[model samples]
Every structure is written in C-alpha cells, then in structure tokens.
Target: MQHRFLLGTRKGLFVVERTVHGWRSLPPHFPGLQIPAVLTDPRDGAWYAVVHHGHFGTKLHRSADSGRTWTEIASPAFPPKPADAPDIRCPMRGVTIPWSVELAWCLEAGGDDQTGRLWCGTVPGGLFKSDDHGDSWSLVTGLWNRPERAKWFGGGYDYPGIHSILVDPRDPTRLGVGVSCGGYWVSEDDGATWANRSDGMRAAYLPPDQADDPDTQDPHRISRCLAEPDVLWCQHHNGIFRSTDDGLSWKAVPPPEPSGFGFAVAAHPIDPETALFAPAEADVCRIPKAGRFVLTRTRDGGKGFETLTRGLPLDEAYDLVYRHGIDTDATGNRVAVGSTSGGVWVSEDGGDGWMPLPVRFPPVLTVRFV
Candidate 1:
C-alpha cells in the first residue's frame, strides 16, 4: 500500500507520496512562510498545517479533502495588534514587513477524540488550547500564568519556550508539554493545572564557566515517550529515565551503551517493551561521530538494549540525530530518522535493515508516520 507524507518545510507545506519506486515531493501548499507542524488525520481525512508568519503571527490551513484545495484559519487567540504592528517576536517597533518567525513554534492536533482539540506552544511560550479543532482557541490559564515559573526557570534565559505537546493518546485529558530550559510539565485534568516533572531532572544553574553549553555540551535537553499512560520514557542531558507512576516520580534507566547524548525517544505503537533513539554528542555540534548511527532498542523495559545498524551508512565517522526527530510506524516494524546532515533512512525489518528513500529532505526537523 502507498502512503502520503505531509512535510512542513522552511518555505511552505508539501506532500510526499510513496510511489512504486520511492517518495516524491509535491508543489508548495501555501505561498510563503515556514511550516513547523503538519497533521494528517486518518479518521476525518483532513490535512492541517501550521505556518509561522514571522512577526505577523501564525496561520493554520486546513483541507477537508486532502491537499487538492485549502483555506486559512485566522488565529482566534493571537493577541490582537494594530494594523501595522511590529512582529510576533517584537511587537513594539510597528515593524510592517514581517520578520522570520524565529521559532515561536506550535504543535497542533492532540486529545483523545483527536478531532476537536489542538494545542499550540510558542517561544517565551504560553500554552493555548483549541477545543473546536482549529476554529478558535484559548490560553490554558494555569500553565500560561504560573506564579513561580518566572523565578524558578529564570525569566529571560531559562523561561519556558515550548517545542512539544503530548496528550495521553489513551486519555487526552492528561497533557504534557516539553519546554526548552524549564523542563517538562504535566496536566491531569485536561490542562486545568500543571506540575513540573523535572524532579529527577538536573536543574543545575551553571555559571558561565561551569555551564555545559548546548552547542558544546549535551544542551541539557528533555524528551518524553508515552507508550502507556502510567509509563513514560524520558531522555535528558544527563541520562535516560523512566516514570512508572505517571510523571510524579522517575527512575534512571541505564544508558544502552556508554554514549547517552540522546536527542529523541520513541516507543513502539503496540510493543511497550520496545522503543528507539539516536545517539549524538552532548555539546553544540551533536553530530554522530563518523556516521556511527545506531538505533538502540530496549526489549526488557530499559534493562538491556540491542543496536540495529544493518543498512545505515557507516562511511561517515559521525552520525548524529537531534531531539524531536525520530519516529515509529503503526506496526512498529518500520522506523525512520532525519539527520542534521539532511539524511533520511527507513528500516522496514524492525530497524535491522534500512532503506535510503529517494528524496533528500532539508535537515529533517521532525518525522511522524501515521
């Protein structure tokens, strides 16, 4: 069977189809702007893409009939501004010409029903919720206005800037959001309130000299996997951790190998005992050393790991994978990785062997198979 892949590109949105030979990219979905997130709903057969409009703010486009035609969903919660406002990032200078939406990104379409809810996260970020699909939205008051957050996470440098929003696939009311320096937060009552899940996380306030620069060190990142509501696979700069009692507590899972500068973590759709990740340097340039790419899987609940590098390119010495870019298919038999060097590799035999797809996508920012 052939599959359609929705690509959120730097310039615009594109669709890729699996042909008899390989994948092919279609024309741009919209005129200009970067598409940071795209969702292909298997249930309703709708396509939704979020566009970053620099300072002008963000836009959402939806197609009930696939990519044949489109319509824009004017953001309902976007803080209204004067006609010639500055930008989304800097809204003071009356900057008319739009600026590059500097990563004030959003991850849309979450919740149990998977049709009515969509969550958006932004830089200096605030959490916004939309229950009517993308028609309108409202800020999650508790998360957006945490009293102690400004002091706890540092207002300027350590403040919250969201990158990922995960709602329990099994129970959409329970929500989780991943922030840059603030770490992770969880909401049990459908985002009515949030609690920090960084208890086991290292919140080291490093001095300039003592700091492990994200560029040189592991960037002290945090990523999560929710294969089960009670069990979450979390990866941090220091090590890998597992939360058995939801996000309330955590236990450190021994690194599969010596190298643990992990960027992403993915749990198989059905196989709870199985998950995958890519290893890289902890510092600024987290490239794989000499294309030494390996897909590490833990079969016995992080007790032991097996490496799958069968068809992965071994020529380059360093093969690095970044955070938020690895994913598993519905059957869990196939896996794909997007590299900083702009490489895409797919494994159909459960990560034992990989097939290099035909398209050379831009340095892959994220990969999702649905």
Candidate 2:
C-alpha cells in the first residue's frame, strides 16, 4: 500500500507521494493560506484542510477526491457583537471575527457510539461540534459557559489559546485538550462539561516573564498517546510527565538534561513502550540541542532516556521541531520531523539516523500520514 504524507506549513499545504523516483511534492493545495492542519476524514473519505483566509479569518476547505478539488466549509465564524460594543465607537479596538478553526477531527477514530460527527478546537479556545461532517459547526456551550473558567483565565476578555485536542480513540466522549495558559481539560460526556486534568503537572518551567501567574502552573506543553490511553504523556517546559489512569493523575518524567525544555513528543503506534522527543535549550531558539541536535527516546516508559542523533546536524542548525511537528508513519518503522528552520527529516530506522526529505518545504508546523 502506498502511503502519502501531508505537510502543513506557513506558506501552504504540501503533499508528498512515494513513487519509483522516491518522494516528490505536488503543487501546494492552497498557496499562501498559512495552512496549519491537513487531515483525512475516514467517515466521508475526504481530505480537510485549515488555512488563514486573510483578514476575514482562518478558513476550512475539503477535497472529496484526494487533493483534486476543494469546497469551503462555513467555519471560523465568530460570535456576534453585543449592542454595547459597536465597531464605530471602538475603532481603535476593532474586533475581527475569527473564521479559522485550529484543529479538526473526523471523530471516526474516537471509540464512541457517536462517530461521524466532525469536531474542531479553535483559538480564543472553544470546542466546535459538527453533526453534518464539517458542512457546518456549532460551538459547544457546555465548555463556553464554565463559571470557574473565566476566573481561572485571569479575568481577561481573551483567556487562552488551544494548541492540541485529543479525542480518546477508545471513547470519543472522553476527550482531552491543551491550552496555552489554561492547562489541560477533559470532557467525559462528549463535549459537555470539562474538568481540569493537571494534578502532577508543574509550572516551574515557565519563562521569567510569565512565571508570576497561572501560566506556569498550566500544562503549557502537552501531548497524548493513541497507543496507550491510560498512559497520557506531555513534554512541558518543566519536563515530561505520564499519567497511568488517563489524566486522572500525573508524575514527572525529567529529560536527560536539567535546564532544557521539550516541545515535540512522538509515541510509537504499535509499541506503546517506545517514544521519541526533541528537547531544546531555549524556547525561542530553534536550533536542536543548541547546535548539538538530538532526538531522545525512551523504551521503558520514561524510566531512562538516551540521545539518538546520528545523522542530524551539529553545526548551524537553524530550526527546532515544535510539539505537533513530529510523527510516526503507519508502519511504525519511519519517524518524520519538521522544523521552524524550513526543513523536514525522515528516520527510517526509528531515530537511529535521519536524512532530509526530497522537497524543500517551508517552516513545517504539522506532519501527518494520509
């Protein structure tokens, strides 16, 4: 079987196919869209993409026949303005509606009875549920009306931003997501009410400026494993952590180095025991390992860590991988990583070594197998 890969970059959406001549890139599906997400919907056999749609906001497009044709889905629609706050009066504080959705899912893989519903996590951070497979979406009021959430968000009009949304593969109703300064939240009733899931997570790693508030306490950097639902893992600024009971509780998993923070974590699809992460010395600096680039791995569930940087660069490495920028192919044999430095590397032998892919894509944000 031939497996295609999609790369979402700041420039646009790129497709890579495996042919006799090796990997080749097709023309970007939406040029200059600032595409963030490119995913395949198993329910409708369609490819869905999210892109920045100019001043109007981010837009969602769907391709029914692979990447041939696309139709815009009515999303990124912000709520209406209240009578008290008119645009003309507050021209300096002009409010632009957010039309772009952050993350999208087909919900087919979610192990719930209610499959086929399209789910999206957006900025300004709220969950959107679509019953008609992404044709349209309605914001879930259950999460939007949380009384304590406002107070927890520092009483600001703009509380936080959502980066990752994970719907339990075994039970879709049970979902978990990570917010920039809001920590982590889980919903057991399929997008209804959510409870904070940051018991063992720490705020010690927060930067000097944001360390004064609740942002550090939040699980600012988090990721979930599909192979082991009970074993939820996150690579935060503080360190790494794993939950045995599916986010009910957590324990710290420190990296090899004490001063650095990790951004990306990739779990083995079949072998839950094996996982990979990229740790950088500085959050702003993208150079892997401060010029000594490395991808660390753990086989015994974070008990011990080892450096795996054979083919990666050690000098003048410009880009560092982000949280969502690393992933494993379906076969579980190949690992791929993208960087803010505008390069993509593939490791066929599990992180033993990595080689650059054929295409010269832009700073890659997320990579997924199709």
TM-scores for all candidates: the values are 0.80, 0.84
Candidate 2: where is the Cα deviation over 4 Å? 81-115, 151-159, 205-221, 257-260, 284-286
Off by over 4 Å in 1: 27-33, 54-57, 76-104, 112-115, 151-159, 203-227, 317-320
Backbone clash total, candidate 1: 23
The residue-by-residue lDDT of candidate 2 on 25-55, one tens digit each, is 7988788767766667655567888876656
How many clashes does each candidate structure show, in the order listed? 23, 4
| Candidate 1 lDDT tens digits, 258-370 | 35657677766666667777877554447664457666888777898887777777666455565556766667776777665656777776677887756655555556664
Question: Residue 257 CA error for candidate 1 (Å)?
Answer: 3.4
Error of 1 at 317 (Å): 6.6
The best candidate in terms of lDDT: 2
Model 1, C-alpha of 110: deviation from truth (Å): 3.8
Local distance difference test values of all predictions, in order: 0.62, 0.66
Where's the lowest-lDDT run of ten residues in candidate 1?
Answer: 91-100
